[model samples]
Target: MTTPELGLPMAVPAQGLPAAVRIYEVGARDGLQNEKGTVPTEVKAEFIHRLADAGLTTIEATSFVHPKWVPQLADAEQLFPRVSELPVALPVLVPNERGLDRALALGARQVAVFASATESFAKANLNRTLDESLAMFEPVVNRAKTEGRHVRGYISMSFGDPWEGAVPIPQVVRVCRALLDMGCDELSLGDTIGVATAGHVRALLSALNEAGVPTHTLGVHFHDTYGQALANTLAALQHGITTVDASAGGLGGCPYAKSATGNLATEDLVWMLRGLGIDTGVDLDRLITTSVWMAEQLGRPSPSRTVRALSHKE
Candidate 1:
């Protein structure tokens, strides 16, 4: 029997898309945060190293939230120093002033603050009102900026929320604007529940632009719960968004939102981007190997479709 060929897709250049895309890899942090069993700190460090070796320039290393909130990432201090020598950008998620201070003390140059658009999510996830959460972030963002760190603000539920269905574009825009105004270098709009369609993605981008947020400063973080992540990403690309947040092997869901599912898989996003003739600078085979290894460590098969298909061929 003849062996089947495992090859890359034919490059079909898509118009109106950027020549290159910056994939903000989040597997180490967001991916492992929701795991039922704790992933060992050494293994998590190795995962980040493997991702950087696969050519992902921006990798979120870990979160500095309190151990009570996310016990999985309680080893942020230990993990950060282990992978700090990597040449890529290692952005850690900082929930507030305390988290930011922990990251800064460890020489982290890039940090991200996670925020919510709706009042319900703000209260549930942050134990504060939407405005109060923003107020809390104000000091964190300002301090990070004062220390010369590049801050990224992630606005969750930009599309829809389980408790608050169908988030208004204006509502999302307000949060985005607030973050940008607070000195965030970029904003990642997250569809936490994966309920956004292509049109919704475009409409929200348009609204942010109309509100004076530049397309260059926006990134899209879509969940594949309803299988709309890739579609929504294409819409964002068409609107001139160049930064995208994807998790390796499709790992991670919002711990606060039960309905939120895994993030858009890095491998899947790379496959589509490669087919579109867009550059992501990732070694697909290497990334697949990393995800497969991570899945082995977790004792489960990877949820990424591209990882499954390509790894099978290997």
Candidate 2:
């Protein structure tokens, strides 16, 4: 059969139109970690499997932060060992060198580090200043390199913060450049409070790209607090970002920032991308099913629009 001609997404001279984009599923870790209740270890593992099956290339499996901070993910060690092996990448969050040690002990080959764009967010979430947090990450990044593990960095509140509204472009750029220079494989700029608009996302990405940061090395993690997650994502895509961070059913929020809410829903993102003729390699029906099942496990309605819509039809 002849392929239908399509042009809106644009084609690169050598690559043609990029059909597939990588999605780093963050449900198991970021999604469940912020829930008001605890999710059993077995349920977490099942969700991870479902995400992998949905064609997510990278899944943030868990975090190694102190159990006291995120009691919901206290079973990271046990759950990681029980997950079914997949060809997809499985990365987890590690706050510091000590957290990295625990992740490494569990044979984690990929990990993520995080630093905040605002001093207040850093102090509240990590109990350190922005400089101190970056300083702490240096050792962790170096350790991960020495251990032959790939590292991705996160700069939270890239667009806005609850305590410090409207984060400056230079602040976001500085943190992003630092993470890249520290040898992180990629840096995900987070709209932690979901207050950013498409204009903000476009401007920030353009500024960073013009400063010599390749667009492919950047990813977007936008929360849906203001109903702008998908719009921001499209702006990122237009700027050549190939990876997006999302959580199934839109689970998770910032405990320190009450205004901050669910991360972009994986089901919603997949539906949008598919509609745009972008191939994420994810099965939308399966993804929605997983979202509904996950919401049932948590005993709450899913925060995903797509999941809610689809579930009602079924």
Candidate 3:
């Protein structure tokens, strides 16, 4: 199966969109974490390097979580140093202070802490209550900040939960506020079950802004289970959000949230951004080539619409 050269999107500038966007690439960490088989550490490192060469400025390398929990990324120690020399922001996910220590030891300059906006998700994912998880993250965020590291807080199930269903705006706001208060430099609002619609996304962003959480400090991480990731992302862009979290080849979903599906594909997101004339500094041809190569490695086709369409696999 030969990969086809993809054409670029026509630039149509939209009103109220940011001049440029920061596409936070998560395929190496969040993308690979849910895979059933362990990807070789060398393959993982090369994946990150290819993404960087594709002009993705920020790539999440790997998670420092215990191997007992996320065995796929158990090679964090071996994987991080392999690509730490890349000229890009390589952020790793740290579950707690212990995870933070592990990442810092590898000279990880940026780290992310995961949280849940719903009680059910907190229990299922973190094995703690909502508040308990926050308390657990407080020191992690504080210490990361004190050590002069950039800390990002991820609030999962922001729009809906499989167990809880339709999450309230205020409930999500409280979690966002708590993370920000704990010295988290930024927060990524996750539509964990992919149940968010465009309207729900707008309402949640409005609520967070009213609750004193600035749009500049927020990012959006959407799943495509409901096929609404692009619409929800458009809503976020209209609200002045410039950061987005995406997985290459649409490779990841939440391990704990079984109903969740692959993340918004970086290629698809970049396609829309290019059409809007919103600069993301991503080279579409190179990015698609990387994703197709990754899909070959996984022995499956890519789930991304753009990847399929470009490769003529659709």
Worst 10-residue lDDT window, candidate 2? 7-16
lDDT of 1 by residue, 1-314 (tens): 12322657777887788999999999998999999998999999999999999999999999999999999999999999999999999999999898998999999999999999999999999999999999999999999999999999999999898997999889999999999998999999999999999998999999899999999999999999999999999999999999999999999998999998999999999999988889999999999999999999999899999999989833
**CA lDDT of 203 in candidate 1?**
90
Alpha carbon lDDT at 22, candidate 2? 87
For residues 1-314, what per-residue lDDT tens digits would candidate 2 score against the true structure?
A: 12433311232222333467888888888888888777889999889888888777889999999899989888988898877377778899999888999999988999999789999999999999899999999989988998999999999999998888899998899989988988898899999899999999999999998777888889999999989999989888877788999998899888888898999999888877766667788877788888888888988789798888878832
Higher TM-score: candidate 2 or 3?
3
Candidate with better lDDT, 1 vs 3: 1
The deviation in Å at residue 288 for candidate 1 is 0.3
lDDT (Cα, tens digit) per residue for candidate 3, span 73-142? 8999999989999999999999999999999999999999999999999998888999999999999999
Q: What C-alpha lDDT, on a 0 to 100 scale, does residue 75 get in candidate 1?
A: 100
Error of model 3, residue 258, in angstroms: 0.9
Candidate 1, number of clashes: 0
Q: What local lDDT score does residue 148 receive in model 3, on the 0 to 100 scale?
A: 98
lDDT of all the models against the reference?
0.94, 0.86, 0.93
Backbone clash count, each prediction separately: 0, 0, 0
Taking all chains together, each candidate's TM-score versus the true structure is: 0.97, 0.93, 0.97
Global CA lDDT computed for model 3: 0.93
